[model samples]
Target chain A: MNIDSIQNGVVIDHIKAGKSMEIYNLLQLYNLDCPVALITNAHSGKMGAKDIIKIDSENLDIDLDVIGLIDPNATVNIIRHGQLVEKKALTLPLELRDVLKCKNPRCITSVEQDLSHVFRLTDKQSGTYRCLYCEAKAERRN
Target chain B: MRSLIDILELSTQEIDELIATANDIIEHPEAYREKCRYKKLATLFFEPSTRTRLSFEAAMYELGGQVLGFSEAQSSSAAKGESVADTVRTVSCYADIIAMRHPKEGAPLVASMAASVPVINAGDGGHNHPTQTLTDLLTITREKGRLNNLSVGFCGDLKFGRTVHSLITALSRYEGIKIVLISPDELKLPSYVKKDVLKKKGITYVQTRDLEAVMPELDILYMTRVQKERFFNEEDYLRLKDMYILTPDKLHNAKSDLSIMHPLPRVNEIHTSIDADPRACYFRQALCGKYIRMALILKLLEIE
Candidate 1:
């Protein structure tokens, strides 16, 4: 790997090339003070094309389940003192809270301002989540 | 006593109580007025439903309650990215009850969980429409004077008709009810409804494409719009659009006491000429909707 090493940071790898922006927007990472490195269109033997984001700072709280939903192929690597400290594989959450919007037009969440648009994962393998309130399934788009 | 999020949660006695209350309200309108004098109803319609929204507002007004809330999603804070739970929680503080219509299938269920006040599901996407089911129940009882041993025909758009699904489920709980399903092959009732409600309940039913053939045998004919959008091909829509129209000629052989009902805002399914007939019960069905809702509001609020 010809990738530059980060002294102390978190590396998110194997994300789909163009979808890193969506993951970035979802996490609101741009407003943070940490040094962030976003690598796009990277080579991957399994994926053919990939992207990576390396954030250098203290341990930041990010919802990896959401990132997995946005790009399931992605992996997270925690780095410490220029060495890989911990590597964790991401999976979709059993119940998603305050994340995606239920696409159903008649869903009460779409009208009520006070309710958190929550969904419970009904099928993890198929990437199927049902709205907790409306039972509307939120399907993962490939 | 509170919000009605799912029909599965309502027992047989509770449904009967609601129906009885609705009937009482229909009979004596003055007795229930000012029942919820200082109360307010927040009708948060996330989708476009002119009929359901108006009915809910009318129901509230008839109870001497004020109505607030938007008719569409664009007019609400949801477009500004506010969450459903937060919105209901806020509205719960302002209104005594909330009647919401959302495109998402379980939206009202979600709102009910967060709302401190009673949350009524006016409608939700292609999912359940309990209120419509209640209206149908009230209509059938008032028209035929009974809920059981009747041959009911559900015609047109059975596949996407949430009201049809709800009605079938509600009626299945009763004894000796036979169903006649009339629709094009492309718009046959969904298998889930057939397997879950009709077949499981041991309710006898016959499926056909001819509406007139079944019209004479039916005690009640529930007509729904066969939308142009439901057809994938333009030619299929054209072929089926007029396939089930209930014109005067078709009603010649119909039962004398057969009540024609529609969960309306109909396009061309029912001819205007039939409106003058005694069996044309859709307009009365609309009024029944308001009374049922009025009864519902009174019951939920415990206003007697």
Candidate 2:
């Protein structure tokens, strides 16, 4: 598959395999008018299998921290005038607001639809995010 | 200025201060009778709680503060699908402070975020009940005469007992605090609690299935009821039903001075026979609940 690289855009690489669709939906990349390439099950020496999303738009402004929350291993490469200008690695955000919804049934956010799903990164090594209100552990998604 | 969401939010000194204030209230009730005269406390209980709700109302009333709000969800706008944030935001306009109890774990936390006044989490599901922890702490300090250097054994339903979890988290902060967790393997204390709080704090603790064996070693024995509602399997509940019944025969092995505490509404965990035992302090624990809540109300309102 010959997917063209963007002259000035962001290439999100090393997303966990088959998670490209989730990333696509979360970032609302489908709403963008620019050409977007979502490559799934790409063989990689580091990840064994990975998903990569390449967005071909200079004005595509995405919160890279959000990508970090969803998929921490993913890396973002900024293309400037067809050259790699920045290779940014993702880190678990210290605080997240409305990125990942709290799944605990007893969490207030579950009953209150208008409340923002807020979480604080309690443990970095284990990637533990606790509900800001109920302190319930955020469930890990496959 | 802040909310009491978790027991860990309080420092040992703050806890001590609260205990001291509670002790003062016990000695001179008339002094605090007019503290919260013009204030109002909104008790937004979205769940059925006899002791917690009443204790909060009693606390506010004891401070001469009026109490309002519903005792359950069906009576309130929450049943109509109003959010916790909106409920508290609206209640904040009516009351000087809010004490909310919900079956959901983080509901009061969501309330605290929106409310302009201080929010007190009365009880939130199987999550933190800081006030209960405060009540337990005050009870222990009063009964044992010291908070440190005590071998405390937590018995029965350690798994889903929010009181046990909060007490363990709080007690770990005190010096010479040794915890003996006595529960069946199926209902043992959660590993995250063991790893994050106990081990991280370097608090020496041992887990055992035999309650009788550890009973003799404890200076304080905190008993918790095995909730039938928490179990999905009926057979599992029946099988583990009578694992640790504290009878007079079993109490013989325990220390005479062992301060027996329970965040009550217990069902068959403690025999009625043990009620006469001098060590049984659960009733006193309940009374302490009211007093500590008064201190908490004063602290939150900054009435001192």
Candidate 3:
């Protein structure tokens, strides 16, 4: 199978297999009017099985922090006029704001309707994110 | 502008300063009578904590400041579906400082973010009660004459004991503070707490189920009530509520000068017989709560 190369867009490569859907949903790719292609279990030389997302819009601005939190090894290539402009590597964010919700039932974010759910990175090795309000560990949604 | 959401927010120097101020208040009560004159404190308790609410009220009153606000959520606009942020935002206009207690953890944090005036976390569910930790610190300093080099035993419901967690976190900052965690397996202290507050700080701790065996090893016995409000099942609460009753018989092996302290509104976890014992300092802990709170109010209000 063959997918068309984007003229001006972003190519998110090196995603861990089966995580493209999560990245797509978190990035709200469905809301974008531009044509988007998600290639799963693609062949890679460095990574065994990788997922890639190709966004066919030059003007689109996506949250790289979301990608960083989910898959730090993922790389983003900015394509301009069918040529790679910038290749960017991702790292875990120190703090996430409104990107995820606190799962603690007793947390203030659970009761206060208008409050923004915030999580702070506590453990770098474990990639542990704790709720800013109650300090409850944030579990990644499967 | 400033808030006391966690006990760690206050530095050791600040804690010492507050303790000194509380000691000064105790020695020369007349001098602090007009410290907070014309200032107002709002006791915004969304939960039904008679002791903490009254402590803040009494603290402000003793500082020559007036007090206002509701004791429970039913009496406040929270009953009308108003948010904590909105309530405190409005309360900031009327009061110089706000001492808020809510059943939802981190509600006071939300209040601090929204309110213009300083906010003190009186208590917030089973998450944190910074002022209570300060009270415990003051009580310990008064009883033992020092905060460091003591073996502190925390008994009862360690799982849901906010005071235990806060005090441990606070005391972990001191040198030579060894924590003896006494609780049944079902109500053991949470691993995250042990890691974040103890292990990470390199504080020595020992977990045990047999309180009697560790009784003599303790310098300060911090007893906590198994909170029924934190339980989803009544049967579990009933089974664990009476687990660690600090009867006089339990004190035979304990040190004669041991500080038997509890964040009060105690259930049967501590026997009424222990009340008359000189080792019992829970009542004195409550009084320390007021004085430390008075210092907290003065500090927050930046009063001379």
Tell me the deviation in Å of residue A16 in model 1. Answer: 29
Which stretches of candidate 1 lie above 4 Å from their native place? A1-142, B228-239
DockQ of 1: 0.37
Q: lDDT tens digits, residues B1-304, model 3?
A: 5889999999999999999999999999999999888989999988888889988999999999999999989999999999998898899899999999998898998899899999999898899999999999999999999999999999999999999999999999999999999998989999999988899999999999999999999999999989899999999998888888889998999998999999988978898988999999999999999999999999989886
DockQ of each: 0.37, 0.78, 0.87
lDDT at B25, model 2:
100
Tens-digit lDDT track for model 2 on A55-74? 99989777776676678778
lDDT of 1 at A73: 76
Q: What fraction of the correct interface contacts does each predicted structure contain?
A: 0.86, 1.00, 0.86
The window of 10 residues in a row where model 3 chain A has the poorest summed lDDT is: A61-70
Stronger candidate by DockQ (2 vs 3): 3
Tens-digit lDDT string for candidate 2 (B45-131):
888999999999999999999999999999999888787878888998999999998988887877887899999999888888999
The pairs that clash in candidate 2 are: A134-B106
TM-score of 1: 0.71
| Displacement of the residue B215 alpha carbon in candidate 1, Å | 2.3
- For model 3, the superposed segments whose C-alpha errors exceed 4 Å read A45-48
lDDT of 1 at B144: 91
For model 1, residues A21-103, the per-residue Cα lDDT tens digits are: 88887777897798887888889898888988888876787776678888877889888888898888777788877777888
